[model samples]
Target: MSIKPENINLNKIFIKYLNEKQYSKLQLHYEKLGKTEKQLPAIIFYYACAITLNPSSNIKNLKHAHNLFEMLYVNNRHDLQLLCNMIELSFRTQEFKVVLPYVEEAYKINQSDERLLLGLSKIHLYLANLKESIKYYKILFKINPKSKINRDEFLTSLNYASGITQEYYLSECKNYLKLLETNKDLEDYNFNFKNLKNNKIKIGFLSSDFKTHPVSFFLKGLLLNFNKDKFEISLISNLHKSHYDNITDELKLLTKNWININSLSDSEATNLLRSFELDILIDLCGFFRGNRFQVISNRAAKIQACWLGYNNTTGIKNMDYLIADHNLIKKEEEKLYSEKVLFLPKIWNAMTPSNILPEIQKNNSIFTYASFNNFHKISDDTIDVWSKILNNSNSQIILKNPMPSSIVGEELKLNLLKKFIARGVEKKKILFINRKKDFQDHLGLYNNVDVALDTFPYPGVTTTFDAVLMGVPVLTMKGHNLNSRCGESININLQMQNFIAENKDDYFNKALSLQKEKNILQNFGKNLREKVLKSSLFDTKDFTKSFEKIIQKIISK
Candidate 1:
């Protein structure tokens, strides 16, 4: 039956009760509407809204909601509001696959809607559809050049693009920075140089990830081994405490000063940092989330450098240096970066090993290749290359799902599985593992892996170190950019250059060759820990000394 004029009143009351969070009233109003074909849209819309408001309330709890949606699907409701609400609910619940059809339908009705464009862009990016993300970001930029989300997302999309050249990426970064500079009142600072007579050199580090992050993992070694008499260290953290605050207490003891600047505005933060009068300020969170570029822009320290948190350039003109090693950044590549290169003498990062080691596998005839890198790094080109390797070898591949607990995470895993299956690889041959809660259990998974295959154009850094520390050899494909060469850098430090491939064909050949030589793999696996411990990769004391020397020389100059 069609909706009567009186039924429209019930719809309005239903919405009002839903907004007021009057579930009892909302149920009364919904019942008042009665079961009619025209009322189905309103029923479904209200049901979705109720579930969103209270997550414990499922759509199944209201039998009419499901039946209404199915009926509406068969016969067009043409209700944009209902579609929008459904999309909103799906997004809120992280049901991205459920949101796609609703988004597509909404987009058709209002192509020029900014919210629709932004939502579509974010959804594609979340789904790891890099090309589609870039497309929508470009459109959003064209429509609204001042959109900060579009600018940030565009840069992130560029980072994930494996085919993009360094020059092109640099150009985009410069243009983005130019826009930001023009929009803000960024004033340059001129600090009077004062040479300390006998006091320690005051150094400050800026980062939002001083807790259980990879940045903290690599940075703790330097902080722990610092020459306290020569340098006084301080930290400006943007986040108070994270679940991964394993080194929090240790860091506080090592640091002379620790400031939590998460609550401060950019201007306020810059002023606070300037008050510290830091001799050297190093930005660990370069272009990552919660980055205080304004503090560096205002010149909070005499010398400023970017390191660790991000792999590429920040494109900020005031930033003095981008710390790297000769391996990660070649002299020729320095021209593309916005900041001057500070080439560390040894490995740029020094990893602290876990005391608990997984028992190395000794009996497996079948060689199992694995990669624990994040899924975003596994681009289409990377998948194609990996498929070729799998096709060439009789070995099966294992991948770790970084966010295995979420719906989006599961979707990403399914997408990867589909891509592998399309490449003539058997579904049973591929395995997707979840991230382990305990760090020891996480490392223990390395026991199952024969060799770790590195993701191209954005290779593993911490994953590589962990694999080698666990006596698993990582095969990395070298690329022109810094993001791709991180694994290679670690390999070079561990003196495993033979595992690094120059190109795709070489990468495949290297894997196949390694699979054939089980004795070499076994020997490498047995002695890998000793090799890493002896190398500069874990030589924290030496790395700290060399790092301090570089800072001293920079200040002296």
Candidate 2:
């Protein structure tokens, strides 16, 4: 049935916004349009209400909006984008659950709309549906083969919460490099390195992860080592002051200038960076949430590059270079980036001093297996591997995480434990921990654990660093993707290849062998602390030199 042209007039609705009463009358009239025309009018009415309704009117209006969307039964592309916009706005207003049905519908619609795919992927990740999230990410990657933006976004989001699609991670990395070669803008990324001598190069570091974040953990060492007299360090913080923590406090003291860019408009942030006259702006939080990727698009900084917080190169054209080491990024693998590759001597990650307690060897009665990595990284394959380890060693697994603290945490813990038990790991053997104020006590907790298990597809980076620092050896599986291969990187650098496993049998064999050689394990753990301290991994001074060299080289070009 064709509706009258008067039905969808957007201008007629705008005229009704002269006053509150008129707006209400217009909204009611829009709702009536939904009753007669099943789909199009319903979609239009919801779209209008979603945009026009005030906070006081939002809750009631949102229900009608959602109902309208459901009645529309949208299966087409344009309708899907509109639905995504509706769901995204709902998420902003703490209406997280209300969007799920729409997300489900979106998943069923096309699954190829890059935006829809990513939005739905995020919701699944938020819900801790790791496998489902990976499924959608894989589809998104396949559809946008040339899109570095989609690839980087999918990988970054996957890496942060759960893990990554191992098969896609490496291929995408190579594709990004190929894109970079023809990228003329980044060809002479080394232009201003010689200019480093002309004046102190104004270096700006941008990130939303400046507070109590893993990015901050790795960055602290580099910032502490920067030659403040030679490099003027400016920080573009895309974070609210209310969210500030002790980590931010520490970082604030390290940078030469700190600007809170969260509240500032995009134009405001651009003007502020331009005013600072930044010669080299380093983007630490590449494509991660609240990252201000648009700032790079604006070319606010003269020289922009993506560094260590994220592993893969950002697909953004404006980002000039990606800092990598020889091991993590192979020379043969350089063609997969959107930015020119600048290889460093070793792995880019550097450790810092953060009140870490010394390792205590305890003769706890129970043989404990501990994995401190996040719960999302705990995939079905990972759980199966750990259950095998437990069965082989006759040991209990203690899975400790900072999440699952409150009542919600308890429920999540129970659900996860049940999943593990279903896979053959005894329910009694598994342990879950909620938030702990003094994470320094984690070292003491490690005393109860004889071994620390690593998750694959996305192995632990900082977690491995910490486990080693605390003298707990991590048993890791090497795989094809960069996400899974980091354990091999750690093993190679630490001179502990024996600690790395190639396959399921090798992983189980390594765990069993380590258990038998308690003395060797103890000695290795003690020496791991010494090894990290002596190795390039902990050499902040050298790392700072290497980092500055890259910056100087870029600036001189």
Candidate 3:
């Protein structure tokens, strides 16, 4: 190979340096080529990129990189490379708002640009503006119906929406299936079902959240206590390697077959799964992130079902059954889902009981309410009732979430605080807690909480259970659909009907009323942990039996 003058793209050389980890070489080249007007932009862009991409990048260097990108972005408004650098670096320093105007301007310049729309939609979602986020995703889908990423983001956004009726939601789901009909669906696949009453039934669970997540807690009891002799198990984990934790190790200890499909493509993974000869393949991710619905669309096993992780219908008809308990799904509402609703006997979920005491000993006199759910689930309607609860009671509410550390996390808290401020609650009346804690420490913090205030339209499932496990009863408003009614189902299983609120006013009223019965509530909390263990909600053995019976019946068919 001969080096030819004018044959090389300087930009390509810079990228090569980055890809090869030639940081010193890149810096040397930039210094040597310093004063050329044509090479300056490329040099600055790549230099800033290197800083941001470096693992040891600190706050000072990150800010300098952010500034360099901002300068380049100002000169080259239409340069997507520069714009992307600006977008990424700004978020690193928590100055995400700095790039908003540029992003929106770029979108206006080219509304059909997929990257711009993606960045915009993600920005809106992070800002707690789901409506705007959904709107952009819908636009992106309309532009490129064949793009799976676009469709995935669009459908995930729809998961947070509450359609006026179940029919309206089902129609939306049907339309998604209709769109995917054009893709290569494994329609020719057939299942060879044998009489599995004598042999062990092989069940493969697909999920990305088998690690430290809400899904893991809900899935714990089942995986740990399933009739392993009768039902052979395998786990397909779809999460990035960095996300694997102690919980992932725990899940692996339960099953002999652990498939790491994190690096496999959809087709590769599907082909590998088909070779497993699975009798029943249940998708735990549902429509949430890392769902293998596309693989399910191929019918990988004899019987396919979806449960846990997500509450509502996945809208993908390939999922033959949607697992639910009687309390979780009403008989009349079965028609709302595309899949047949498989009703469990008592509860659809059961978690491992914590060994540590559920409640931390709180000596504070101020009454406290808290929700350990994610911040995005807190809608305006949710804040409406919560704010009223704060205004009427002589107490403060503690809101905990998985936010970034130090000042960066504090900024997100302010955004949430402003929402409550608009609804007449002062900042001081609400306290924010960081979610970085040991599992035992996390459970103990529930003791300081007087009542766990569940969010509406999309109530907390695992968090609701977490509260009960910690001797704290969650106050949740009951609603019609599955997403809104999860708390209802969990509470019903525990026979805690008084904890359920019927409507908005009822929710606020119940919150205030519960505050008045502080002593009674605390005494009840002391025994609630014991009650939760005995109830069907935490009874792993009984729940697993019900689960196995359903799986056995399906395979036998």
Best by TM-score: 3
Between candidates 1 and 2, the TM-score winner: 1
Q: What is the C-alpha lDDT of each candidate?
A: 0.76, 0.69, 0.78
* Model 2 Cα lDDT, one tens digit per residue, 283-377: 88875667776567566777788886666666666788888766566666666566788877776768775655655576567677788877767
Error of 3 at 66 (Å): 3.4
Off by over 4 Å in 3: 1-24, 31-39, 52-63, 90-94, 162-165, 185-198, 358-360, 402-411, 521-523
Model 1, global lDDT: 0.76
TM per prediction: 0.86, 0.73, 0.90
Once superposed on the true structure, which residue ranges of model 2 sit more than 4 Å away at CA? 1-120, 136-153, 157-198, 355-359, 402-415
Of the two candidates 1 and 2, the one with more favorable lDDT, higher being better, is 1
| Model 1 RMSD, rounded to 1 decimal | 4.2
Tens-digit lDDT track for model 3 on 61-115? Answer: 8888888888887887777877777777666776666787889988888888988
Q: Any idea what lDDT model 3 has? A: 0.78
lDDT of 3 at 451: 86
Q: Can you write out model 1's per-residue Cα lDDT over 1-557, one digit (the tens) per residue?
A: 87876657767877777878887656656566556544655565675456456535563543334344435654664555554555555444455676576666777887776667777887777677777777777777778776666565578668776688889888878777766565344343454544553277788999988776788889988898888988989988897565326567667777889998888877678767776777788999876667777667667777789888888887878789888898888887789899999989877879767766777664455789999888877887888888887877788888885444643456667767888889888887788888887888888888888889988788888888888887889999887877668888888877789999999889888988888774745587768877877889888899999899988888778
Rate residue 118 of model 2 by lDDT.
78
Q: How many backbone clashes can be found in candidate 2?
A: 21
